[model samples]
Target chain A: MKTVWTQKGFLIPAGALLIAILLPIFASEYALHIAVLVLLYAYLSTAWNVLGGYAGQHSLGHSLFLGIGAYTSTFLFTKIGLTPWVGMWIGALLAGLVGWFVGYLCFRYGLKGPYFALVTIAIAEAMVSLTNNINFIGGAMGLEVKWLGNSPLLMQFESKAGYYYIALVMLVIALWLVYWLSRQRFGYHLIAVRENEDAAEALGVDTLRVKIQASILSAFLTALGGTFFAQYFTYINPRNVFGEGPSIQILLFAIVGGLGTVWGPAVGALVLVPIAELARGWLGGSFAGAHLLLYGTVMVLVMLFMPKGIIGLYESIRQRLKRGSSAPEEERTPA
Target chain B: MSMLTVSNLSRYFGGLAAVVDMSFTVEKGEIVGLIGPNGAGKTTVFNMLSGFIPPTSGEIIYQGRRMNGLKPHQICELGVTRTFQVVQPFPDMTVLENTMIGAYVRHPNTTDAKRKALETLERVDLDAKADKLGRDLTLLELKRLEIGKALASEPDLLLLDEAAAGLKDTEIEDILTLIRQLNREGMTLLIVEHLMKVIMNLSHRIIVLDFGKMIAEGTPQEISQHPAVLEAYLGKDE
Candidate 1:
C-alpha cells in the first residue's frame, strides 16, 4: 500500500518494456530465435518463482505442467481439429487441477522442504517414464505439432518474430502477475508461510491454503509456457520437455535472478540465456560440454559477488548508496 | 466466564509425558500466569493451547468450539493466538510487513491489512522501526515484534509463552506495561514466564507446573506461599 512503484521504478520498467517490444521488429532470425528462447525461459522462471521463490516451496516437477500443457493442446489440436489458443487454456486448467491435487496431498500430509522437493522430483520423473511407455500419448516417439502455414488463429506462425513477440508478451504478463501478487494479501500469506511456517500459522495464516494456491497458480502459468513452447517449436517429447533438466533450468533462472523478488526471474533470463547461448556457440566443437562449464563459471562468479542473486545484489547496493549519500546507517547490522 | 477451557490435557512425546493432565480455565478478562522451571512442560502446554500440538487425552474448548484437533490458524481464527517461547520472526520481512502478515488474517485487503498492522506496531512501540527487516532487529526488538505479530491477529485470548524470559529487568518492565495496557483494553492474556516477580505482579492467578503436572494454583500471594510451589522451585528439605 505504501506506493511500491517509485518514479525511478516506473521509468526503468517502462524503458525496458519499450526495448523488449521493439527488439523483435529489427532483429535477425538467429537473434530473434535467441530472444524467443530468452523470453520463454523468463516466462517459465517467473512461473516457478511464484511457489519456489515467494512461497518457499521448491518444486522440481514443474516440467510436468509444461509437458501437460504442450501435450494437451497438441493433442486437442491434432485430434479434435481445434485451434491451439483455446486448447492452451484447457491445458492450463488441467495443469492447475493436477497441481492442486499434488499440492493438496503434499501439504495435507505435511511434506516440507527437502521432502517436498523429493516428492516433486519423483512426480516429474514418474511422468517422464510414464509418457515414454504410453502409446496413445505418442510414447517415446514424441508428438509433432503440424502447422498449416502462417495462421494467427492457430497461434502458429512462419516468422520467428511472431513467436518472439508472443513469448515476450508471455514474459511481460508473468512479471506483471508476480508484481501484482507481491502487493496482495494472498502474496503476503505465501511469503509468510515461506519464511516460517509455524510462526505464520500461529499468527493466523492458513499455510496449507497458501501453499496449495501457490502450487496451482504456478503450475497453471508454467503449463501455459509449455503450450507456448509446443506452438513455438512445433514438437514435444517426454524426455526433452518433461525431463528434470527443464525443471532445474527453469528454477536456476529464478534462483540466479533472486528467488523472491518479482522481476528477478525475468532479469535472470535476460542476463543468463544469451550468455549461455553464446557460450554454446563459441565452444561448439573445440570441446564437448565446455559451454556448460562457462555457464557454471558465470553462475559461480555472480554468486560470489552477490550470494542472494542479482536482485539481492542490486538491493544491497541501492541500500548502501542511500545510506552513504543522504543519511547515516540507522543501526549497526545484526551480528 | 471462561475464555479458554483445558480439561484433562496431556501430551506425550513417545513414552515421555511433556504435559500431564493440565487443566485450567482462563477468564474472559484476567491475565493468567503459567510458571515453571525449565523443561517443566510450560512450552508444551502453550503449544497445546495454541493448537500447535494436540492433547493426548483431553479436550480444549475455546468459546464453545473444540480446539484439540484444530490447526493453529483455525484456533487463531477462533480468537486464540500465541507467541513462541523462542522468538520467531520472519527475518526477510520489514517489521510492518511481518506484522501485516498477521493483520491479513482478519482484513483480507492488502491496504486494510497494512493499516491494521501499522496500528498494532504502534501499540507495541515498534512504529519507529517499521521499515527495518526482522533480521536487523535487536533481541528486545525481536521479542516485541513477536508480541506485535501475535496481537495483529486480534485474538480474544492472547497466549504469551515465556514473554519475558530473555529480557533485562528494565526490558521486562516494558513488556509488563504493554501486557497491562492490553488487559486494561479488555484483552485476556495467558502468560508463561520464569521470573516470579514479573509473573506475580501481572497475573490475576498463577498456576505452577512441575514434571508436567500442576503443583499449585492460586493468586500470586497465595501461590508464592504455597508449600508445593516452593518444593517445585526449591527442592524440599528432608
Candidate 2:
C-alpha cells in the first residue's frame, strides 16, 4: 500500500520520467541530445543542491567532484581492465574524501559566507590548473574511452537511448537521495546549522561535523554523475569537467529552479536547457554569445523577481488558491 | 552538597573587567537568584558558569569536578544546561525538533530523544505547539521553549537568564509558577531576573551585583532593605 511511486513527492518526478521515456520516440537526434544535456545538468544541479540548497553552504566549485570523478574513473578503466561501473564507486569515494578534507579545513577555520564562496572558486581554479598540468591521465589534451562496441559490461552502448536511460536512472537516484535526506533527522540538523551555526552548536549539534557530512555526501553523489557523463560522452577534458562552465551550470539550475526544494534543479534544467538549445540552433552561427546573453538576462530576472526560484513561486500560488477555496468553504459552514 | 561552585572567577573584555572575583555556591535542590541592574555582569556570570565564555581566572566546580575550561556542550553533558537571555531556538526547525536537539544530550536514539523531548515539552506546557516552527512562536511560547530545551538535557543545574523578561504580568506569573514547580521537584536552579517581586518571591536567597562586583548577598527581605542595594539602583543617572 505504501509503494515509493505512490508517495506525495513522487508525482512530479514520475510525470517527468514518463515524458523523458516518451520523448525519444518523437524527437529528432538533435532534440534527444538536448534531452540528454538537460538530464546531465539536472543531475549536477540536484547534486549541488544537497550542499548548497539544503545545507545553506553555497558552493561554486561543485565541478571539483565532477572533475575528480571523471578523471578517476576514466583513468582506472583505461589503465586497468576495470569496468566504468566499478570505477564509478572508486571515483565517488575519492571525491568524498577530498570533500571531507575541504569541509574540515573550511569549517574548522570558520571560513564562511562570501569568504567560503571565494575559497570554493579558488579551489575550482586550482583543480583546473592541476588537471591541465598532469600528464598521466592525458593532461591538457584529455582522455578518450576506447570503443567497446555496445558492451554492457563496459557501460558503453551504440544507441543514444542507452545514454538517455542511464542519465534518467541517475537523475532518479539523485532526486530520491535528496528527498530522503530532506525528511531525515540529518536534514533537520543540516538546516539548523545552516540557519545559525552558533545556535546549533550551543544546542549540542556538532555544526562542523554536520557540515562536513553534507559536503561529503553531496560530493559522492556529484561524482557518480561525473562518471556517468564521462561514460556517456566517451570523452573527458579538463575544460569540460573542471571548468567554470560546469560549475556555473550546476549553480544556475539549482538557483533558477529553487535551491532547497526537491524538484528545483530538475525544473530549472527542464526550463533552461530547451531554451538554450533552441537559441543555439537559431542564432548560434551569426550571434556567437547571444545564448549566453539570454541566459544572463533570464537569470538576472529570476533572481530579482522570484528570489526563491520558480518552484517557490508556484508553491506560493498554490497556497493562495488553497486558502481561497478553504475560506469559502469555511464561510458556508458558519463555524 | 553544593551542586555548583565558582571561585575567583574573572572575565576581561579588552581592557575592561566584565566579571571579576565572582565566587558563589549553589546547594542541591535550591532556587538561587542573581539580581542586578542592566549591564551589571549578571549575564557574564551565567555565560562563565555555563562555559559560553571562559573565565579569565578561577575555577568552577560542578558536582565536585572543575568545569571552567570545558566547551558549552561538554558542560551541558556534565548536567549543566543554560537558557539564553535572547532565547536562541533553532529558527528553521519545529519546536519539537528544537527540543529534540536538547534531548539528544541524554538520549542519542531518535525514538528515545523524541520521547524525552515530548515529556520535556509537556513539563513546560509547550506540547500543544510541538509542531509549530520555532520562528512562529509567541514571546511566551519562546520563553517556555527555551526552558523546555534546558529541561530536555536533563540538567542537574539549570541556569535561567532573564527567563521572565518581556512577558505580560500573567505570563510572568505562569512562568513563576512553573519555576516553583520545577524547584519543588528537586531541581537546582540559578535564575537571573530584573523583576524585584518575582526575585523576592521566588528566591530563598539572593545575590546582588553592581558594576561587575558582588555588592550584597542575603535573604530576599535583607536584600530589599540593604542601603547599598538601594543606592546602587537610585544613584544611577537617569
Candidate 3:
C-alpha cells in the first residue's frame, strides 16, 4: 500500500511547508519576522550550495553577488523611478556576468584549493573598498528608499506576511534547482571534478567550463535573493550586503546543514535561524554580540563533533536503525 | 602509414638525461611494446608522448599533425589517449559513470554517451559492476575500469602504461585477451610492460630501453634470444 506522495519522498517538504504557513497564525508578530529572516537565509544558502556544495568549489566571497544584487535594484529604483520587481532580473543578470568574469580569472590562472577561496575573499574585500570610495549610490552612507506610500507594486509590504510568502517561494525555487542539478549530467561532472580533477579530465570532462557554469548559476540565484532582501527591508548598505557576517552565515547554513546535500542548508537554516533570533531577544542590548559568539561556538562544536554535518549525522543514525531492524529479522530465519 | 612519429625527443632533469635522443614510429593498427628496466625513462617517454610533460627538445607528430606543446585534453581530442600506471578512476563515481565521461568526448549527449559507455563496459566484461563505485571495486576491476575509460575516448592510438603490472597471472591473461580483442577490432595500441610472457604474446614488435637508450628493437622471438636484452634484464648472471 505505497502511496504516490510517499513514494516520491516529497511528503516531508509538503508537510513542512504546511506547518510553516500555519505557524504565523498562532505565533507572535516578532516570531513571524524571525521566520521570514530564516526563510531568506535558507534560500540564499541553497543557492550557494550549487557552487560550493555540488561543485566542491569553496567560495568565501558569495556576499559579492548579494551586494551587487542589492545595489543594482536599489540604485535602479531610486535613480530611475523603476519598481523593484522590474529591477530584480537586471540585478540577477549583472551578478551572473560579474560572477562569470571572476570565475574565468580564477580558473584560467589555475587558482584552486585554498587559493581559490582566498581569491573570493579578496574580490569581496576589493568590492567593499571600491564601494566605499564610489559615491554614486550614497557611498559609505548607504542607500534608503524614501516612499510617499507603501505600495505592493513598489515591493514594499505593510505586513511581514508578504515577505514571508516571497521568501517561501524563493526557498522552494532554490530547493527545486538544487534537486534538478543534483540529477543532471552537468551535476555529475561537477561532482567528478570535485572528487578528482585529474580523473575527471582523463574521462573527457571539461572541468573549467563546468565549474564556471556552476559559479554563474549560483551567483544569479544569490543575486535574486539579494534583490528580495533589499525590497523587503527598504534599506541597503555595503556592510550589510557584502559584510563578513553575511558570508559566514551563508556558509554556516550550508556547512551546518550538510555541505553537499540538497536539503542540508535549508534544514540548517530552519534549526539555527530561530535559535539565533531567540538568543538575541533573550539577551537584549546588554548582551550585544552574544548571539554571534554563541553562533560561532555552535558552528565550531558542529564541525568538531559532527564533521559530516547535521544531515550526515541524521543519515548515519537512519542507516544504523535500518541495519538493526533488518539484520535481526534475517538472523531469526538463518539459512 | 605511421599514426604517431617521434623524433629527437629529449628530456633532462638538471644534469640527468631522463629521455635522450629517442625516435620511433608506431605504424597504424599495430601493437608496439616498450620494455625497459627500472628508471630507464619508459614512463617519461609515455608522458612526453601523451602531452603530460613537455620534451626539452623534440618533435611529436600524431595523425600527421604537430603535437609538441598541446595540453593533455587537446592531445586526447586529437585521437590519442593514455592510461596511468596508477589506476585513476573517479573513486566517487560508479563504474558506468566513469566510462560515460570518457564516452562523452564523442557523444556529448547524455543518452548517446550512456549507450556508448554501456557498449565499452560490455566489451571489457565490467557491465556487471556498472552500478558499483570505483572505490568499492577490486584491483582487477580498477585496472579494467582504467582501460574502459581509455577505450571510451574512442582513441586512434591508445598508450597503456604498465597495464599488467601488479596483476596475478590469470588477471594478466584476462587483460591480454582483452587487448588482443581490441587490436583485432582495429585499434592501435602502444603498451609498456615488464612482463616477458604477456609482451611476447601481445606485441607485434618490441623496443627495449636501458639507461634512456634504445638497446634492442625486434620481434618478440628475436628479442628473447638477444644477448643485450638478456644482459639488460639479468645483469649478465647467465
Candidate 4:
C-alpha cells in the first residue's frame, strides 16, 4: 500500500509536469496567454497554501503582501533604475517583515478562525486605501513599466512563452518548497498546532514561533508571485494587485484543490482557472459575472461532496479499491 | 538532586483559585502521583508546571533552573514535557509523524527525528501502528500512541495528565507496566490520575487534593488511610 502510494505520488506529478512543459509548444498565442495566467495563479495559490492551507490560518489579505511586492519592485525600477530581480528580493523581505508583525500580533493575542480571516480582509482593504494616497508610488495613477524590448534583467519578456516558463519555474519552486516543508518536523509541528493548539503546547511545539515563521515564509513566497505578476502584465495598480479579489481567488484555488496538500493549489489552478477563463471567453459579456456564477456553483458542489476538497474525493476511491482488492488477504488472515 | 520543585505555586482564574499555594518537590528517578477528585485542580497544576499557563504567583524550578514564565517548548528544550488528559493526536498525520514532532524538540534534522520517533514507538510497543493515521487508532492504541509521542521528546521529567483514564483493568495494567519500565530506566514521572489501583501501584509517593488544596502527601498506604483524603475524596464512594 505504501509503495503504491509513493509510486503514484511521483508518477502523477511527473506526468502532469511533462504535459505542462509541452503545452506552450503546440498552443495558440491566446491559449499560451491563458496557460501563463494559470501558472501565475498556481504560484499565488501555492504560496498562499504555505500559511493558509498547511498552517491552517485562512488569510483573505495575502493581496496586501502581493501589492507590497509589486509596488516595491515597480518603484525600485522606475525611480532607482535597479533591475526587477534585485527589487523583487527587497520587496519579498519587506513583505516578510510585515507578515511577521501581523502573525506575531494575531497569534500572540489569540486571534484565530474567522476572526483571523476578517483581520486579513481588513488589512488588504487598508493597503488598497494606503497605496491610493502614497504619491511616491505614483498614487492612484498607477505605475507602468516602459517596454525595454526583451531585456532579461528587466524581466520584461517579448513573448508570452518567456513569461510562461518563468511562471512555470516559479510555480515549480513554490511547490518544491511546500513539499519540503510538509516533510519536515516543522511541518508536522504546524499540523499539530492546527489539530489542537493546547495539545501542541503541552507536547512542546512552540506554537507562536512556528506560526510567525510560517507567516514570514508565506509572505516571502507570495511576494515573488507578485513580482512575477507585475513583470507579466507590465503594469501595477493598487486595486488590481492589492484587492480582495486576489485573496478570494487564491483561497478558492487552495481550498477547492485541497487544503494542506502540496499539489492542491497547482491542481486547483489547473482545474478552476482554465474553466473560469474559458467560461468568461464563452459567455463574452452577454451576462456579466457569469464566470463567477460558474465558480459559485462549482465551489458549492465541491464543498458539499468533498469537504477536504478534490484530494479527498481521490482518496476515498483509492481506499474503496484497496478494500475491494484485499478480500482474499482478509480471508487468508482469518479476519 | 531534585528533578523539579514547585514552591508556593498558585493559579487563580478571575478570583477562583484552581491550585492554591501548592508546593511539591520531585526527586530524580521517582514516580510521583497527584491524585484528587474532579475539579480539584490536578490538571491545572500540570498545566502550570508544563508552561501551558503562567502561575499567578510562585515558582516552577526544573533541573536547578527557574521555569516560572518559560513557554512550553522552552521548558521541553530544558527536558520537561507533558501528555494531555484529553488525548490530542494530529488527525491528519500518521503515528510516526506525530511522534516525530515531539522528537523534533531536540533533533531538528528529519532523519534523526524520524529515527528517534521510531525508537520511541518501538519502546512503547506501537511500532506496528507507525504508518496508521492517528484518528484510525483504537482507544487503547491511541493512549499508547500518546505516550509514544511524549517519550519521543526524551524528557527527563515527564508530566502525565490522567494517562490511565478510561481504560479497562487489563489495558490500565499495560499502561502501568509501561510507566514502571520507564521509571526504572531513570525517567522521573509526575502523573495526575483518579484511579486508585494504578496510582497506588505505579507511584512511589502520592499527593491527594480536595477543593484545590493538598489534603495529604504520603506513601500509598498512608494516603489511603488519611482522614482528609477519605472525607474529601475517597469518602464519596461510601
Which candidate leads in DockQ?
1
Q: Report the error of model 1 at residue A37, Å.
A: 0.6
Fraction of true inter-chain Cα contacts (below 8 Å) kept per model? 0.93, 0.36, 0.41, 0.77
User: Which segments of candidate 3 are over 4 A away from where they belong?
Assistant: A1-6, A18-27, A284-286, A317-335, B13-16, B122-125, B236-238
TM-score of chain B of each: 0.98, 0.97, 0.97, 0.96
What local lDDT does model 1 show for residue B53? 83
Model 3 DockQ class: acceptable
Per-chain TM-score of candidate 1, chain B: 0.98
Give lDDT tens digits, candidate 4, residues A173-219. 88888888888877887788887777677677889988999999999
Clashing pairs in 4: none
> 2 or 4: which has the higher TM-score?
4
Clashes of each: 0, 0, 0, 0
Which is the better candidate, 1 or 2, if ranked by lDDT? 1
What lDDT tens digits, residue by residue, belong to model 2 across residues B121-209? 99889998898889999989999999998888888888998999999999999999998998888888999998988899999899999
For model 4 the local lDDT of residue A154 reads: 90
- Please provide, for model 3 over A261-301, each residue's C-alpha lDDT reduced to its tens digit, 9 standing for 90 to 100: 88999999988998788878877577889987886788789
Ranked candidates (TM-score, high to low): 1, 4, 2, 3
Interface RMSD of 4: 1.3
DockQ versus reference, model 2: 0.48
In model 1, the fraction of reference contacts reproduced equals: 0.93
Each candidate structure's TM-score, on Cα atoms with residue i matched to residue i, is: 0.97, 0.91, 0.90, 0.96
By DockQ, the candidates rank as: 1, 4, 3, 2
Error of 4 at B167 (Å): 0.7
